[model samples]
Each structure stands twice: as C-alpha cells, then as structure tokens.
Target: MTEIVRARGLVKRFDGLLAVDGIDFSIREGECFGLLGPNGAGKTSTIRMITCVSPVTAGQLRVNGMDVTTDRRRIKATLGVVPQDENLDPDLSVAQNLAVYARYFDIPAAVARARSDEILELFQLTEKRDETVDNLSGGMKRRLIVARALINEPKILVLDEPTTGLDPQARHLVWRKLRKLREQGITTLLTTHYMEEAAHLCDRLVVMHLGHILAEGSPQDLIERHVGGQVLELRIESDGDHADALAALRDRADLRLEDVDEAVYAYSTDQNWDPVMRDVASFGKAARLRESTLEDVFLQLTGRGLDE
Candidate 1:
C-alpha cells in the first residue's frame, strides 16, 4: 500500500508549550485512520499540521511524498477538510454553499454545479438543496458540510470530530455516509472522541495523550494488547469495609490493576476470567465483569482526568 501521509519526529509549540511532541506515524492509501483522545490531547494540533494549515515546529511531515512546509498548496489541493466547527455559509442555500466551495478548487462552473448536485444526492440532501443553511436541521447542515468537502473530489478527507454534538439518529446517518466514503476507497483521517465510532470505522488507529502516542494498532488489536480479553470493574462501596478487601483483591493472582476514583479495574484473559472473578469473590467484594473495550484501554493510559 502507498503511504499517502507520513510524519517523523513531528513537533508543534505555542509560546514554549509543546502541543505535539515529536510523534511519528504513517497513513496508507485507501484506509481509514483515526486519531483519538480527550479534550486538549493535541488531536486538533496534529491535524492542522497534516492539513498544512499550521507549520510544523520541527521534524518532517510529508503528504503524498511532498513536504508540508514547501508543498502546502499542492497538499491542500488534494485535501478535503470537515472541521469540528461547521464552516458552511449560513446565508447561502445548501446547493450554493457547495458551489461556492467548489470554486476554491478552481472547478469549472458547470462541473461544480454537477458535482454539487451529485454529492447532495449522495448525502441524501437533495430535498434540502434550495434551503438556507440556517433553516436546515443540525444533521442536514452536517451532511451539507461533508458534501461540500467532497466538491473537489479530494484525495484525502480530514474530519475533526464530525459527529460530536449530533443526536443518535443523526450520528448514525453520518456514520453511514462515512462508511460509504470508505467504500469508495477515500483515504480519511478522522479525529473523534466516540469509542464506538473508532471501533466501527477505523482500520487502524493511535491513542494520543499529552502530545504523545500511547499506543497504535487496529482497535481490536490495541484492546487485546493493552487491556487483555476482558475487564472486571470492582466498584466497592467505599464504606471502609471494602478497603482491605480491595487491597487484597489487587494483590491476588498477578492481576493488572488500575485504580480510578472509587473503581478498581482489573484485566484478565477470557480463559482465566471466570476463575479471576471467583478469586475476587473470596475478598468479599462485589464486582461487575464484562468484555474489555477500547475505552478501557484509553482510560488506563490517559488517566481519568477531565480535560476541561
């Protein structure tokens, strides 16, 4: 597979604060790659460098084998970006929004109109074609924004938290549209906080925290590697009686333990999970055991701190 985007020792800083601290990764052509983290985890900063909107502070970043510093225009020409913020022209109708954006790529008037109509139909927004951006529902506006990004049929689509604030129905619709984009072999770089979205969409992904990549692999691979096959959450009622039991639980059976707030998260393989839970019961603590997930691995590496 061709490497469409590559970064090595990439760094970004603002007023002496390191935002992206020397990270390395590569993206293959026609695969969906994800960047995931909580708020302020440098996800947006890394994307800006990839999109050539922000200059790299240090190290090399190449898009389509061209350096981002010198070949920004060329790189951007092949990129279609849907930012976390809706950048649609609120005053223009849905169809006009796409037409105006198509001109940015120097698309011919007739071709722009045709592609605008085509993508509108593709995103299921043909009925809202003549409606003003402000009149459409949040979901319709999101569809239009994604449709506008494809006006130029860009080689790479960069989506930053595309489904952040949408309702469940709207998010699912957006997911369906993104799945279609993937089926079209679009090389996509997506940043989202939703674990389910990452697991469902990403072919490969890296977990980022504090400007560093904590782990990298396919979703299931990362989960199995970092978190084992299952997670047992022991939420002991912090009524003083469970303290000794919790400590004893931690030392039992060579288990990996992460203490977050009031919960002691334990990781065990599926083959040993039943016996592990049986051992925990001897400590007189009630625990809930379930399959380990990407979220479990994320919190384990990044901690439970709220990034606000």
Candidate 2:
C-alpha cells in the first residue's frame, strides 16, 4: 500500500514543555488510522502539525509526499480537518456557512453553491440549510461541520473527536458517513477518546500517552496481547487473604491477577473460566464472569481506567 502520510521522529514543543515527543508513524492509502489517547496526551498537537496548522519543531513530516513546511498551500488544499470543538460561523446560515468556507479555497461561486446543496442533502440538513448556525442543535452543528469539511473533496480527512458531544443516533450517523468516505478510498486520520469508535472504524491504531506511543496494533490484537482473553471478576464481601485463594488456582497457569477497588480480576487466555470460579467459590459466590474488552487493555497499559 502507498503511504499517504509519514512522520519520522516528529517532535513538538510548547515553550519548555514537550507536547509531542519524538514519534513515528504512517498512514497508508485509503486506510482508517487512529491516534487513541486521553486529553493532554499529544494527539491534538500531532494533528495540528500534520494539518500544517502548526509546524513540527523537529523531524520529517510529509503528507501526500509533500513536506509540510514547504508545501503548506498544497497540503492544506489536499487536507480536510474537523476539530474537536465546533467552529461554525454563528451569524451565517448553514448553507451560507458552507458556501463561505468553500470560497476560502477559491472555489467558483456557482460551484460552491452546488457543492453546498449536495453536501447539505448528504448530511440530512437540507431542511435546515437556511437556518442560522446558532439555532441548530449540537448534533446538527457537528454534521454541518463535517459537510463543510467535505466541500473540498479532500484526499485526506483528519477528525479530532468528531462525535464528542453528540447523542447516540448522531454518533452513528457520523460513523455511517465516515464508512462511506472509506469506501470511496479517502484516507482518514482520527483522534478520539472513544475506544469503541476506534475499534469499529480504524483499520489500525496507536495508543498514545504522555507524549509517546504506548502500543500499536489492531484492536483485537492489542486486547489479546496486552489484556488477556477472558476475565473473571470477583466482587467479594472482603478480599482478605484473596492472594492465597488465587494461588490455589495455579492449575491454570495462563491467568494473571489484578485487584481493583475491592474487586479481583482474573485474566486468562482460555475462555473456560470454571477453574477460576471453583477456586474463588471457596471464598464466596460474589464472583462473576465478564468478557474481556479494549477497556481492560487500556487500563492494563496505563495502570488506570480509560475514563480516569
């Protein structure tokens, strides 16, 4: 596959603080790539550099084979960005907002109007095309932002928390539109805190933390390699001497133990959890089984829960 975006030893700094510490990665043509991380983890800084809104402090960064510093105009023309916060023009109508945004690229007035019409229909906002941006709901505003981004028909789309504050139905709508863009062969770069969003949409992802890459792989591969397969959750009356009880279950050598907030978590590769239950049964019946998830992987990797 051809690499559409490549960064080697990329670094960014704000005053004396490092926002993005030397990181390297690439996005292949037509692939959905994700930067998964919590806030202040350098994901936004990386995106800003990639979009040419901010210059890299060090290392080589290329998009569509053009160096960002030297080819700012070309890169900007080829890229579309949806920032985490909506920056729609409140005074303008939805259709006017798209039209004015497209004009920034020097699009013909007739062409901009046509594009706005088509995009409004695509976003299911044709009925509200004449409505002022400030009157629209949060979800409507997000969809309008996406439609405006697509007005340029950019080869690369970069979204930062595209569904951050939307309702479930609105989020799914955005997902469906994104899937359509993928089918059309647009390379997508996404940065989001929602793990399930990354798992469902991204072809591959890198987990970022503390301005560095923590792990890189497919969602399932990361879960299996880092979080184990099946997990036995025990909410005991009291975990007094639970380590001794856990030691008795050494017959299953594949399991790893974790104790969190009065709950004991037994992780194993094998799906059969009978042996673990039997061992914990000696203590009490409060133990239960839970399927492993990417949340578990995130928690294990960062030593804290994703929401924390």
1-308: candidate 1 lDDT, tens digit per residue: 99999999999999988999999999999999999998888899999999999999999999988999999988999999999998899999998898888888999999999888889898999988899899999988888888888998989999999998999999999999999999999999999989999998999999999899999999999998888878888776765635744665666665777766677788754346766667667545467777888898888878888877
Which segments of candidate 2 are over 4 A away from where they belong?
Answer: 239-253, 270-272, 282-285, 305-308
Cα lDDT tens digits, model 2, 1-308, are: 99999999999998998989999999999999999888878999999999999989999999999999899999999988999999999999998999899989988999999888888888899999999999999999999998899989899999999999899999999999999889999999999989889988999889888789899888888888886676777764545655654566545667787777666677776556775677677665567677688777776766665533
Q: Quick one: best lDDT, which candidate?
A: 1
lDDT of 1: 0.88
Each model's TM-score, in the order given?
0.95, 0.92
Give per-residue lDDT, candidate 1, residue 164: 89
Return the number of clashes found in candidate 1: 0
Alpha-carbon shift of residue 263 in model 1 (angstroms): 1.8
